[model samples]
Structures are given as structure tokens and as C-alpha cells.
Target: MSGCMSSSDESDVSACNHEDQGDASPMEIPADDLATSDEDEEASNPPPTKKQKTLESKKPKTPSQIKKSTVKVGGKCSSTNCSKKALQGGHCFEHGGGYKCSEEGCTKQAKVRGKCVPHSGGNRCTQPDCTKLARLKGLCIAHGGANVCSFQNCTKTVQSKGKCIDHGGGKKCSKRGCHNQVVSDKLCFEHGGGN
Candidate 1:
């Protein structure tokens, strides 16, 4: 018991020595080495800035602006303009609500006794008695035929003034005492028709 008491005292003396050594000041550090000052800290990492968003500029719109858009239909024209319609490859009589030449791709409309500004590939004659494609030529054979001569089957060259008679560049045809070149109301001499 006396030896145990001496060893315990020795251990307590070593613990006291350790406590005294702990009293020494901790290792000194320079003040400059510590993190301080917003600017000095920010030198390593800058603060983020707010980003601005961009937008595209556009023109303002109105009802009139929208109405200006062209439409394909609505309106009509008079008979005088009929020929003009024909030359524009012919049009329905109404002609898109009185808007002449307003067809989507056409530039010509009714003008001067069935005339329109000429365009390529669109002149077709639609005269009542004629059916030929109305082009640079004004009239077709049947209309031209009747205008030049009054008699039926008048196979005569058109004279100085579109006449068909002995005095007008062509000799009258005399087929078996017939009065006209073609069969006609002007009958043969036997029928008492020719004067």
C-alpha cells in the first residue's frame, strides 16, 4: 500500500508538469495572413452583375393595315367591259366586285370598246358569233365574214370597203342560174328572185 501510494503521487506530479507546459502561448500568426476587407476578398472572386434582356422592335398595326391585304373575290362589271374580260383570259361578269384588273395575277381590264393592256398568253376573243382565240387580231371569221358580205356563202375577196359584188373586186358566182354564191333567199332566175 505504501509503494502504490508513492507511484500514484509520481503520476500526479507528471500530470501537473503537462498542465504547466499547456500554459505557453499558441504559435503566433501574422495579422496580414487573415482574410479581411471586401475588396481584398473580392480580388479572388468578383460579385455577379445583373444581366439586361434585349427585345426586337416591331411596327404598330391598325385595322386599315389589315384591310390592305388583297382578297381574291367580290364584284361585277358592265357589258362594255365584257371584251376586256375576254382578253384577260375572260372573266366572270362580276369581276371581283367592280375592281377591274383586280384579279390576283392579271394587270389588264376593260378599256376602249373591248380593249385591255396586252399581256402574254391571255387574249381570247369571246364575241357572240365567233369562237377563235381573240388575240392581236380583233375579230374572227364569222363576224368578219358577215361584216364583209351580206349574202349567204359569199366566197368573194373583201373589196376596198368590205363589199362582195362584181363592182367590188369580186365576180358574183353563177352556179346554174343561181342569184347568190351560196344557197340563199335571193333565189334563182327561174324562181323570179334576182333583179
Candidate 2:
């Protein structure tokens, strides 16, 4: 029989008998290279259990990955170029997100109770005989639901900075060296305000 040893039937019997080993003398391993015992070998290089192997196969994910996975529903709208809040189905009402209005032939987003604003979808004013939309405290803007102007003896609603536009409360003209209030398109009456 050939001196080369078969891979099978080899039990704790090591020798330079492989086909590629040739006539070289048996390899000598230093005493320091051997493990002290089976216990030391197990501790140093233990085979992973089924559970451990499963876990090892899975790589740890980052915090952003975890967060993105959790945002499957009720997060930011998924529609393109839309940054509005999401209601359901991962989209905003304007971008076909939430429930559509209940009125027939109406595709607008529902404001309240499955209806649009024009179809009486929102809360009505609580004041007697008032059919206008409620603004604050169950009342409409004309019924004291809005803030009044802060100018002396001024009862008009505030346009900005607690004052009406008549008292210089709105945005000013964008023209250089012009302090006049904007009448149209950010320009004063003298600078293409009507246009």
C-alpha cells in the first residue's frame, strides 16, 4: 500500500502522509503551541451554538436604522416634495394621505367627521344664530375669537405685531430707501404696488 494516508479512518493519528506532503519528515509542533487541555481549548475557541450562530450572523444596526424601521406609520408624509404631517397610510391629506371628505364627489381631505370645510366638516361657532367656523373658544373671529389691534382706540383685528395694517403692522416695501408699507407683491404704491 502507498505511504500516503487516507483522510477517512484517521483518528488522532497525524503524520506527513498526504499526497502533497512528499517524502518530507513529519512536522514537529513545539510544546508551547499545544493547548494545555480540552478545557483550555474550549474556552479559547468554542464553536458557536445555534442561538449564538444566529445572533452572530446578524450585524448590529445603528440608532438611525432602528429609528427608520420604527417609522412605518404615522410619521412624516411619504409623498414626494411634501413635508406635511402624516395622518394615515404614510401621507398627508393634501397628498392623498388621510380619509377623504364624506361628501359625494368630493376628494378633498376631511377636516372633521369625514367632511370638508365647505361641507360643514369643522366645528361651527357656538354663538347663537352663527353659522361661521369657530376660531377660538368656540367663537368666530367677528365674535371675539381673535386678538384686537394694540393701537390706541383701535378695535380692528391685529394683522401683525399686535397692530392692524392701518397702524403700520404689516410687512414693509422691499424697495431700497423706501419705508412705505407693502401694498402689493412686497412693493409700495409708488413702486408697482397695484401690479
- lDDT accuracy of residue 51 in candidate 1: 34
User: Per-residue lDDT tens digits of candidate 1, residues 1-195?
Assistant: 334446657776555554555653335444555646555888977655433111110122221222221322211112243422211212233332222332345534433333334432344455765445453356545444334444456755454456665434343334554433321233332342222
| RMSD (Å) per prediction | 34.3, 19.5
lDDT of 2 by residue, 4-84 (tens): 344454542344343344554457444555745656888989898898865632322222222222233444556566655
Query: After best superposition, candidate 1 residue 97: deviation in angstroms?
Result: 50
Compared with the true structure, the alpha-carbon lDDT of candidate 1 equals: 0.38
Candidate whose TM-score is highest: 2
Clashing pairs in 1: 74-96, 74-97, 75-94, 75-96, 75-97, 76-94, 76-98, 124-134, 125-134
